[model samples]
Target chain A: MVDSVTTINSDGSRYFLYPADARGRFSLARRLSAYGLIVVYLLLPWIPVGGHPAVFIDIAERRFHFLGYTLAAQDTWLLFFGVSGLGFALFFLTALFGRLWCGWACPQTVFLDHVFRRIERWLEGDAVARRALQLAPMGPSKFARRAVKHLLYFFASLLITHLFLAYFVSLPELWLFMRAAPGEHWAAFLFVFIAAGLLYFNFAWFREQLCIVICPYGRLQSALTDDHTLVIGYDARRGEPRGRAGTPAAGACIACNRCVQVCPTGIDIRHGLQLECIGCAACIDACDEVMTKIHRPLGLVRYDSLAGLTGGVTRWVRPRTILYGGLLLLGIIVATFAFSSVQPANFLIYRMSGAAYFVGAEEVRDQFMVRIVNKRPTPATFTVSLEGLPAGMRQTGFLAPVTLAAQEELVSPLILLIDRKYYHGAFKFTVKVADAARTFSLARSVEFMGPDANLLTEDDHEKHRHR
Target chain B: MNSQPQPPHGPEAEPALRPHSYDGIREYDQRLPNWWLNTLYGAIVFWIAYWFVYMIAGLVPSDGAQVDAAMARIEATKMASSIDVTNDDKFWEMSTNPVFVEAGKQTYNSLCFPCHLASLRGKSENPTAIGPDLTDTAWIHGGTPKEMYVTIKNGVIAKGMPAWDPVIGQKKASEVLAYILSYHKKGGTITLQAP
Candidate 1:
């Protein structure tokens, strides 16, 4: 088969295919794994952990609830770590085995190969029937089948869109949105329909083009793979010098072309290490079946590195693999450290925006606004008191023991009054907050207008003599 | 199974076409795909350019700038209009306007309420309360409305008062001045709140 990404068949005709269904141990293994993955994807959104949806990323409110932990928008850096970790892992895996992800668990491949293809096969029958149906003229019977198939595609697309939306919105919010009139949330309405359209287009039309042309991972795998990297390939050394029916051949290859017909990405395995090979092991199963029928030794096409085929050794502890592995480990460690030590509370103090310092009848006053974020699972009630402050520095507003709900943020206004005796210039003091149970405490220091020791040595004799 | 394994490529007359073995796999002497190389190098070049434009040159603001911009957005959204104290015309015009004075009063009450007291009637005998009363004719720095505006904008450094213009922005300073001037008592009855 031609390796080039084109719609034309090798015989120079339009290539529209219903690839012959693969029935091998590898195919069975993949189908079972896809079932498990699809179940997990469907169930994750509804599962509640620590009173939050399992993996909700509430962008509007700036809160991410991952598994059992709730993180604020301030912790967005963690997402960077998570994404980079995935990237590094991909690199490491690609260096070890070529295109393993593209075939087995890639979302695009999984949905099309396992979900969409199954539905198509069940509806239209096998490869011969599917091809015949496509060629047949429009009639009542055909129109009815076509309509039902498209309706099923629409429903499947809808289900996928629901799952995708559930990640950003809580299950309850999603239900509410669903029950409301579409016009109320115009943007969301548009997004859901647009996503469905894209999914339909991808599954029905784009298909293998996603792997052959659009996917950067295929290109990346080629770049990362050396001769030692493992990949599924036909053993051209054993399988070559094709044997025709009723003709003796030097090589084992019977030239039945079962491997070519079973391929998903539509590439011949005999062509050494093409970019389109997804390492799904479908051809290996098909070739092994053919070899079994011919009463020959198995593994005409198999999972092996080019080095292994060429009489070389495979090194698992190479420098490039170790480098990728080391970085992946480091990323995980740093992420764990950060997640474990996430601050339970964050506090900030700003001198009130408008006025400088106020002179009261009995004291010199300075107003401040305190902002606090409760970064814990439970509701927090904390009493704010001043530290490193001289005696007679009292506060009136904001009765102590401020309470906030779980993941709540509060801004409080307060007045600090220094008794007439202690109006020192810019006195430094700490604003401390302690939980009512005294379980935890956080502090932030601030400057207030108070007696400056410099006042005693004032060169401003006129103001000093008046005092 | 042949007696010995044979290489896949046909007998190559040209050295360039000959498949060389490394670690057992036959290595085809081919360069990496252009797309992959371009993308890898593009990210490197982009990162350097990003560093030059944002971090080193400071053309784009960092985290602090983002916070400041957010604050400025909030400031713009506030009930009061953007105050321009740089121009003397806008300063005095806003000072006399009742609306500006009202906005200033709101700002003063929240920001200055801790020290100045809600009444704006300061005490002279006690050092802590010894701040000159706004209502009283006697002025520590200058008595005129313009002088008070300047003093409030650029505070008396020797004294504890901070320069509010930079912190609260200039227009708000003029508003505070207007609020203060509105009650610059001309020997009237002291309108003090109950203490």
Candidate 2:
């Protein structure tokens, strides 16, 4: 009832009548808007802020910043979990809805429907012009139209290629190379150039073949979907017992096949659910317009499950969806906790050097190196000390202590010397580092290596100590 | 339904395909396209190359190893810069003078106070458990200055303590050693023990 009106243009002319096959629904401007949206999307990753590349996957640096968070190499497991969670989420959604992602949000489908379709309409005219032009004989006018179409395609393709590069290589670097002479950046320029041409050719010409054969998601739909899953399906029961409403027998499906015509994937919804149907709702829009004209209820062709059409409830809360959602929620909580609990930096402890060996006097000397990592966005200072060392052992590295710059690592090594009389056995020492205020201590343990022979016997040590 | 007569057919005409057409759309069996197959093969090739370069070559170390190596390098480099003549004064200075003890205490507070605490209290989270409780008499390593110096220099790697040979030289080790020894003879209530 919300959209139950069926009216037409001014005048009582039947020329604009509705029940006739709906033609010229999509105008030239509307089509171009679709193409322009894609161009804008492709260009976003390359647009830079400040000197930094807007999006960088500097895997070599072991630091990747997507929006702004600098994910270090240590966060690789988090990446793994994140990707897995995403993959499962996609699977669950697809299993329940049947190519909903492909229809509405997939980059591939959006670009093809909007960009490629617009370009095609521009070159060959509307659907009628396109069909007529296909049968037209070779002539200067035809050649000119064809040439213009392809030239635009190539230009659009070039833009796509550059944007893809920006996603990986970062926009700032690309801009620097672009600003230089062609000779200076021939390698980069050439790669982007070829990439654009390839993308253009793929989206412009190859088109629907990508969904049918290349995409695994389409193939996996059969495995993911069931009778209860909703998809763009023709109500074969109603549509089958179908004929023109104005005709002698009016079940109201005149079988005009306009739904098939507008489908980007070139599949007929009337044939029931097919993998080729991206569920773009183009057919729905087309059929709805037809129904309105023919004075029949809308939704003769609509999103519905096989079970629903077969006189069963749609069942909004399926068991599979609930299970998948629970797993996804659990994964999200774990990932959140892992991310929050991570220390902002590394904690380190080192043995002092030159204390490793004893001189002719039989003194043992060894050396050590200690380092601290500051993972904050600003500079931080930390105090370092040794713990769990034997009663007499201590650390000797710092005089004024050290401060680490933002994302910096500071290393300091110390030396320890032991008299032969004190040489007992290997002992463990714990190293503790704290921020300048000594509020939080990050601790680790290390051993003090020394000769066991010089250690006083247990009884001797006790006797000597008592004195 | 019979308003229009059927058109004449040629001798090789095929039978009407029934039960198939919905609103005049005839289904035809068409195989998958060639371009798709080619692209899939191309992706496989790219994947193989990536796998070889990144996984088989061992070019990238694990994240944990990288962190450990980075800390070790920093420690080594720092110790190399601090070696000097400070050890001789400590050896001869008899270090028991309150002047020396106060100086040592200042140094300890500034440098070691974070882990050991201003009260010589031990922290629980220290990975190495570096500073023992000064109040306890358990001298796992002897309480002598020389023993303290050696323990400071040659850190135990297995327990997470780095050898500080690169940051502090032999001389600085001795000064800190003298500082620790001063604590031993002084009538301080602090004792070394477990936290």
Alpha-carbon runs more than 4 Å astray in model 2: A1-55, A137-139, A181-187, A248-250, A347-366, A398-401, A414-424, A434-442, A453-467, B1-32, B36-195
Which residue window of length 10 is worst by lDDT in model 1 chain A? A3-12
* Weakest 10 consecutive residues of candidate 2 chain A by summed lDDT: A1-10
In lDDT terms, which candidate is top?
1
User: Mind giving the per-residue lDDT tens digits that candidate 1 earns over A94-198?
Assistant: 888878888789988888888888888888887767778888998998898888888888788888998889899877888888999999877777898899988
Residues A136-214 of candidate 2: C-alpha lDDT, one tens digit per residue: 9989999998888888888877767777767766676778877999889898888988787777877766666667657
lDDT of 2 by residue, B1-195 (tens): 111111122113343443678889876332223454566789999898778866788677766889999999998986886444334444335456666566667556545554455566443334333445543455544444445566667754443334544555555555555666665554333334331
Model 2, docking class: incorrect
Instruction: State in Å the error of residue A371, model 1.
Output: 0.5
Chain A TM-score of each candidate structure, as shown: 0.90, 0.80
